[model samples]
Target: MSERQVARATLVVGLLALTVLVVVLVPRDVVPGGPVTPAPVATVLSADEVERAETFSRWARTWSWSSLALSIVVACWFGLTARGRRLVERVPGPWWVQVPLAVAALVLLGRLVTLPCAVALQRLRLDSGLSRQAWTGFATDQLTTQGVAIVSTSVAVLVVVGSARRWPRAWPAVSGSLLAALVVLGSFAYPLLVEPALNDFEPLPDGPLRTQVLRLADEEGVHVDDVLVADASRRTTTLNAYVSGLGSTRRVVVYDNLLDSASRAETLSVVAHELAHARHRDVLTGTLLGAAGALAATGLLGLVLAAARRRGAPGPGEPGIVPLGLALVAVGSFLVLPLDNAVSRQLETRADVDAVRATGDPAPFVSLQRRLAVRSLADPTPPALSQLWFASHPGVLVRVAIADRVRAVPG
Candidate 1:
């Protein structure tokens, strides 16, 4: 190739590199609007209750971090492979010619394969184990979150690729940085904004039975603002409950089917289980962990990209870099899925143990386990390998065994 051709090719490679960086690392997710505004009912909690809330927040943070770390690690690994690195080098083509080829490939792969797969997954209905009331809330939350992830990711990829091809080397960094920032902002925005909006639609609890549930939670040191009844039956027939929001807005949510279907003892057992999570402040704990993991993932990905760049990987106007980056993300998630689930399961087990201790009612807990098995139609004895590899929550048989032990204990 002529000298001019070689120079143009190298520049094109640089552009491709810039584009890949923006697409893979840029902050494109939605951002929470402004500061977290505590709700009106937040101040009624006692000092101990406030402490528990903080603990829950921390748990939530942890969960988020683990997922983030896994994603970054996988993404970076995919980005630095020989195929990806070779494309980043931009060997010898006119910059304009290379850009078109790269763009065409991106459109074909992303639109035809990646996007279609995501759409198919979204269309498939999964059973949500809850009453009709709780099921509605779960579906709403899941759909909202998944939609935001897909849209934001697509936008980030498009913006990065387009800008990298057009901009000069000196200016391309700006494109990459801006994309990265936007993604970060978006990630925080969606949850913070959507969570509050959903809270507004939250229905208030009625009837003496619900009131008693609230009273028990309170007596056991779970100072909740309101008990929100969700229609979770749409997702699955499983009995379940959760406590969410913060400050005065914090509420204990129970699925209606859980209350109706479970025996009185079983219902109390389930409530006690969820109440333990609330009292211990596991959500906050998970969130803190998640943030840490995300930061770590970002850092690891940057290192991988840097190493690839040193190998003369193609810049913008190249075909391989963008796909390679996305592939890395996919691989990383596959590896981390099991580990993240393990952490979550560990925390769940803790909540279960605490419930047994708190309620001192193993009979109800045992009953709760039986009902869970029947309603979810879960295998009473799932494979041990599956439990270790994929179980997010402990299996029914395992839970029942624990309850039985609790029952045998002398009060």
Candidate 2:
């Protein structure tokens, strides 16, 4: 097959493979439950929790549909415009030229997609969690950080494309090599540079619960030195928590939204889920996987852009390149997000199991999960496909089932 055809086929296959891998990794069963704890403590939700949940639901509906519409429009435009035809018709260039352009286009496109969503997200009166700084930080954090890689790769793409008309056959090799080099360099730097920053939030205390959580981690042979509670409610009403940082900085963080809304049992359950990540080392695994996915997408798209440039098609302009990068990254990230979350859910499942295992009580975990489901208005039993693609935590029904199943036969 011709080089362009080959590049297109390769892109298709790689994306499909990644998507399949992500789908395959979705956790199907609960992990082994750990020690259980007693007491089904309940806590009342403040007005803030209710407000945030309501806001989140609205924002979710808006952004989800807004972007979905934008995607359809963009796709239709690409289709009607016969944009791909020019790339297809161009004589295949050297591997280097073709590859670099494609990668640059991909990276540029990936970065661009964030802008609209960021804008759409900002339009809402959502809380400021970490996302509060997303727009302003985009220049430094995402654009410049990952943006530089994208721009560098794009420049290489332009050179390849520029060389193609004069030296079509020579274009591919140069483009490919450049693309490869860019990907390799980016793989290492992106993580170190973009490691998630600790957003403004209240610090955790030297309280009993704090001590107990760490003590429990120690019992499981896990070293967890930091625990933080983020004022996530400032960003959005989304009820969420995550364990961020690496090695010594690794911390289990709770969303203030969760803290205020969840009962003590529910709050502990959230923390337990994060603890599972630390205990099972899922955080490290996720960080590595996320970085790898970014690299792979960057490389693949770079190749396509290189080809387009060689053919004299206007290399996707900054406007176009940015969106393309966003599309490709979103596709790649979405494909893997489920598996990433599934890995997380496995640890979470284990933590839930651990909660039971530690305290011989499953009720608290069950209650916590259920309350979250109701309060968050989460679709507890979404279609398997939807859940695989979107859920970051196990569904409430699944979590509750695990709790019930464990109670029937405790470890």
Candidate 3:
């Protein structure tokens, strides 16, 4: 063959390979598992279901976008408003004391601003039957979450600002290690300290389910002395399971609702998925990535604060920059959204794959995913931009297609 003909053939083959890669990565349709093409398009949702799902999706998107806007706006308002800055300064305390008090107030202010919309969102969930939580329980959870957030955030702010003031030129370097330690410490403490405040948990009673769970954990190479069950049925009817903590605290937790609602095969599939997360140390992986992101953020903060001070803005922990600092953090969060989601989606996709292989039956894997979406009122086709910025897991249809592809393969 001539050299030109050989080159053309190679190019054609390369294009075909690239096309296959795209097809493999994305599902061909909205149906769970894979395309039902050449068969008439299968209905995934009834008319009423579609209308309700759309309402839920619209409510969620509004809440998400509004929250983002409010965060930035609140930050800017505090940063610019002389009265707000003065209110923070009126509190008499040490820089440590002063910072915490101001931060607490600021946090409360943000919460108050967003609370109405939050309540509305909860009401929507309740009306849709997604949540079973009473208003009293909901209120208590909110107060608890706010209290925890204020305390943790105040400590973090102290650490960041103190490091900056103490080592102006090397603030990022000094704070990175401490912040990373805090991130890891927080991860380890969460199941013991924070989770119990929200929900009660107990060991899964001695039953066939427990036996199956332990067996799956063993097969997945994860140690599970006892699988714990959270009383999630009290707050939400959503079927779910998760793995949390590390070392001795490492355990698989399934919602009581999941056990009560899902079939034996479906339950096994969920357990296997959680075990995969623990076995692969996904939480630790996330914490490490979080630490890296903190370092980058701290570095950015240092550079910005330095520039601002040169232009006469207040130095660290001085109260004047408190609002600006919060605003900057909000912007940082917006900037990192894509990168964070990319990592999360990759991890979630792998866990889905692990669940399918561990179960060796893609049918339950596909069924469980569809059930979760239908139960949760998830958007059938979220916009691509939304997925890029916010989705932590692959779309349910994509996951189903993965199972379909796997089931098609001969052993």
Give the alpha carbon lDDT tens digit for every residue of 1-411 in model 2: 444544455445445645654455433445435433322222323445545545565566567656655654553334234453333334256544444554554444434664577566655532434244445543455455555565554554454445444444443434444444544444444434433442455567777777776776677676765777776664455577777666656667777777777666666666666676666666555544443444345446556566655764344332223334344444555456665666666656666666666545677777676566555545433556756666666666566666766777766
What is the overall TM-score of model 3 with all chains considered together? 0.87
Rate residue 156 of model 1 by lDDT. 48
* Cα lDDT of model 3 by residue, 1-411, tens digit: 432233234334334543453344422332334442221113445566656777898898898688778877887788656655686778787777788888888888988998877888888889989999999999999999999988888878888778767765555656655776788888888888988898899999998988888888888888864588999999898899988886777778899999899999999998888887887788877776666556556655666776677777787647656777777887778877987787777777778777888999988987898788788887767788988998988777677766766666522
User: Which one wins on lDDT?
Assistant: 3
Residue 149, model 3, lDDT: 85
Q: Estimate the overall C-alpha local distance difference test score of candidate 3.
A: 0.75
Task: State residue 109's C-alpha deviation in candidate 3, in Å.
Answer: 0.4
- TM-score for each predicted model, relative to the true structure: 0.57, 0.59, 0.87
Off by over 4 Å in 2: 1-59, 71-198, 236-239, 260-264, 306-311, 314-327, 330-351, 383-385
Q: What local lDDT does model 1 show for residue 339?
A: 66
List per-prediction Cα lDDT, in the order shown: 0.52, 0.54, 0.75
Ranking by TM-score: 3, 2, 1
